[model samples]
Structure formats: structure tokens, C-alpha cells
Target: MKFLEELQSLKEQIKRRVQFDVPEGTKNIVIGGMGGSGIVGKIFQEMYTKMPVYTSDSYDIPDFVGDGTLFIAISYSGNTEETISSLSYAKKKGAKTIGISSGGIIEKEADVFVNVPGGLQPRSAIGYMLMPLLLSFNVVSEKDVDYAYSLLKRIDENNIKDEDIAKKIWETRRIPVIYGIPGYRSVAYRWKTQFNENAKVIAYSNFFPELNHNDTMALRDTYRKNEFFFISISGGKDSRSEKRIDITKEITKTEMEEVVAEGSSQFEKMIGLVHRGDYVTYHLAKLRGVDPTDISSIEELKRRLSKE
Candidate 1:
């Protein structure tokens, strides 16, 4: 959390550059990529206004895409086969296309291209991926930056002892399942993936009303008494799903522990909760007694897939 906390200001320094036109006259939007890069599109779709955004990780373009569509080819490394394949397909169809990468093959193919600074591992650059998209679409506001910063300040003020929280959450050596409302679902997802890649642990997440209606019934499935449960909640009491969250808390008492995220806006709350998750995962890596800075498995997987 401390390391990621340090990057909050760096994230606030949002920058944008003129790339390309919106396919002459496109309306609907489709973002194509995979893994961590695809998550960027999903984050944009969730938070961005007006535009109907869809993210595709497969080779096929969304059926609705056409000349009036804005297709974004997002590959952090610029060389993902699926994203490249989709980029080509979108371009050949004459859809308005924008390419996002660290200067890969997709950069050469895009009509409007953004080559963000490369060299950092793609997963480590999620903020760059998200910020560029927000800047590109002009979706971000001063409020977003201020909100995130305030949340970070609040969390730091609490003086959350990382080692203590780490011990409590990652004790069982099993998996941590995170739950939250739709507004904070991405944070939950981030936590799960962070554990998967960083802590080398399996994790899961679910949202409010959806979980309230169905998942609440399995409170005592007898399979997870000792398993770790994490709940990520919005700091805003008046957030969209606040009512559903209240109901969730009223019901599930002994099952999972709650980690409150401090922020006044959805954007702040989401990032704030994510800050805690990142810290938790990072510390867990250390507690598991593993080095916090290595990911040989991901590189080897990429190598193996490339060989095939």
C-alpha cells in the first residue's frame, strides 16, 4: 500500500495527446485487448459517461461495430496476437480505430495512435493504461484527482499497520474472496488479481444486489468457516448501492471481515479500497516469505505461449 500510495500523485499528473479522429463519425465504442489491458477498457466502460463501451479479448470484433463505430485496439505491449488480430479486423472493416500500446505492431496499424511510455511491466502500468484512456476521452475531472488524493490521505491518517492487517487477512493461506457493490466491483477485481499475480493466491469477488438476492443464502455452506472473506465498501454513504450494502452488512456478521475504504466520491472510494488491497497483497507476499518484486511465472507463461 505504501509503494502504491506513493504513486497517487504521479497518477494525478494526467496527460493527453491528440491521437486520431473518431472514425469520421462514429458513435458506439468497442475496446479490444486482453488480460490486464482489457481491464483498462472495462474500467473506462464502467466509469466513462455517454459512450456505450464494450471490451473484447477475443479475435472477433463486436457484431455492432462498423464505419460509425470507434474501435480501440489496446495492447499494453502492442503485440498481443488477439488484440493485433482484432485491430486488423476493425481496420479492414473501416471502423474508426484508435491504437493504445507501448509502441508495438498495433501502434503502426492504428489510425490514431497513443504510445505511452514503455519498459514497465504491463500489469504494473494499470494506472497509465486507465489514465491515458480517461485523458483521451476527456472523461476525467479535477474532482477525480482530488477525490483520490483525499482518500489516500484519509487511509494514511488511519495509520493502518500493514503487518497486522496482513496477518489477519492472509492467515489461512487459502483464498480471499472480496465482495462489494457495482461501483467498487473493479476494486474487488483488482484485489483478486493482485493476489493471483503478486501473492500467488486464488481469490474471488461479487457485487451487492446480485449477491444479496442469491449469494447471501450460502452463508454457512460449511466449506468456508475458516476461509478468508473480504468486503470492500464505498466510503460514500449516499452512493448508488448504499442501501444494498447496508442490507448485506445487516445479514452477514461472522462470515467475513470488512475493510472500510475512506473516500467521498466513487472514484476516490474505489481507488482507496484498491490501495488497501494492493498493500495487503504486497505484504502477504512478504509474509508468505517470498520476494515481493518477482514474477517469473508470468514471463515463462508468455514464453511458452509464444513458442506454441
Candidate 2:
């Protein structure tokens, strides 16, 4: 699927609810994935607070992942080496495993498997990777999905602002430094990775209060003013962090583009912000004159690894 089409499919994807019968007595939740598929866990970590959520993008499962753990392995292609290896490790530890993917070894190996729709790139299948987790854990309600779908549909129809933001970033020709405040930390990281893979550009991300301690110095001392394009994502929940974000922009004398999330629910706000970033990435790709769907470098890396 093309980038735009896959991105637009989120509205439809949200309507397709996934049902999982989570094992009783499941106490801890551990998710394993890599790259695009791995991001679902990061986003989930931010939304789910009742339990210990561990997101692993490595070849081995965490030492704490044993019986009574609900281990979810997510790989868009169902073939990611790290995810597959981690799934094996989790199974040995007697964790109840649920695998999510289009189709591959994961389907056969997992204690239970969910076959998400195929043909889209892992990054583009954000809805598919995310919806299952949200629904299974009851993290988001139907109303939240409805609101998010409505917001995304509206954005898809009118994205002139997102295009303008892309143009501004493209004009700088500098690495993007995305900052998220409090609730939107994972969203900021998602924006950074989207810029990296979809825009084919290097991007960085850090959350507020933490970045203030160290990275703020680089704005005035180490890096030139034009070395980075700064963007701040506002969650609107933390007044102190929001004040810090405002102060950081002012003190550094840096021009930072900001995206403030809007919605009644946190889930709606998160999905809306994510969709906005997707549009920005698409427009940036066009400005760069590159194929948004092409990830040849990643493919080549996989090919070389397969040889070994």
C-alpha cells in the first residue's frame, strides 16, 4: 500500500475491533517487538498505568518475564528476528503469549495469535498494531475510538497546516529535535521515528524536565542556532512542564514549532496527534523528492543479516 493510503486507513482500522481472551491471573504485561511494530508498546506504556508494562525490542526477554506474565509479541511481518527470539525466551519462562502479525512463524509459535491485515508497512499499520492492545486491556473505550476516528478523518480531508509545518522543517535542512511534555512523551518519540523512516531524515526526541537538565545547554553553547529544527508537543496536563516548555523556547531564543493535542479523552488526543505527524511526514517526503514507501536501506540491512 502507498503511504497516504495506509495512513488514511486508520479510521477504518479503528472500527475493526480485536478481541483477545487474556489469560486469568495474568499479573505482569511484557511486549516484544522491533522498530515500527515496537512503537505500539511504547504508546501503550504511556496509556496503561495500572500494571507494570515492559517494552522490549531486544533478542532476549526480561528476566522478570515468567509465569503470570502476559507477553505480547508484535511483528508486522511476524518474522522480526528479535521479536521471534524474545517470544521463544518468554515461552520458556511459561508466560502466556499472544502474537500479533499478518502471517509468519509467530502465528504457529505463539500460544495465541492475532492476524492483523497485511500489505501495509509496519509503521503504516499503527492502527492494527495498537488497536489490539488497547481493546484487550480495556485501555480505551469505544467512544475514544470514535472521537479519534472523527479527528483523523477531519485531518485527512484538510492538512494544509501539516503541509506548512513540513515546508518549514524542510526549509531548515537541519535535524529535527522533537520534545514531548508529560503525557505526550511517547507521541514525541513516535514523531521522531516517523520523521526518520518516512521522511528519510535524522530526528531526535526527548521529554521535558529531563531535556531541561542537559540538552537545553546545547541550544546556546554546543550547537549553532540553525543546527536543529525544534518542535514541542504539548499534552496540556502538566502545568509545570508546560511552563518549562514555554521557558525553554524563550530562554534559548530558538524558533520551535509546536503541536498541541486536542480531544476530550487522552486516547483521542494521542491518536489525533499521531495522525497529524503522519501527514507532516508525508508532506516532508514529497518535499525531499523521495519515495515515501521505499525503505531500501532497511531491506538491504535485513538481506545482509540473512546471509549470516
User: Judged by TM-score, which candidate is best?
Assistant: 2
Model 1 local distance difference test score: 0.70
TM-scores, each model vs. reference: 0.85, 0.97
State candidate 2's TM-score: 0.97
Question: What is the lDDT for 224 in model 1?
Answer: 70
Model 2, runs deviating above 4 Å: none
lDDT of 1 at 69: 84
Best by lDDT: 2
The pairs that clash in candidate 1 are: 1-279
Q: Any idea how many clashes model 2 has?
A: 0
Clashes of each: 1, 0
Residue 131 miss distance in model 1 (angstroms): 1.7
Worst 10 residues of 1 by lDDT: 9-18
Q: Candidate 1, TM-score vs. the true structure?
A: 0.85
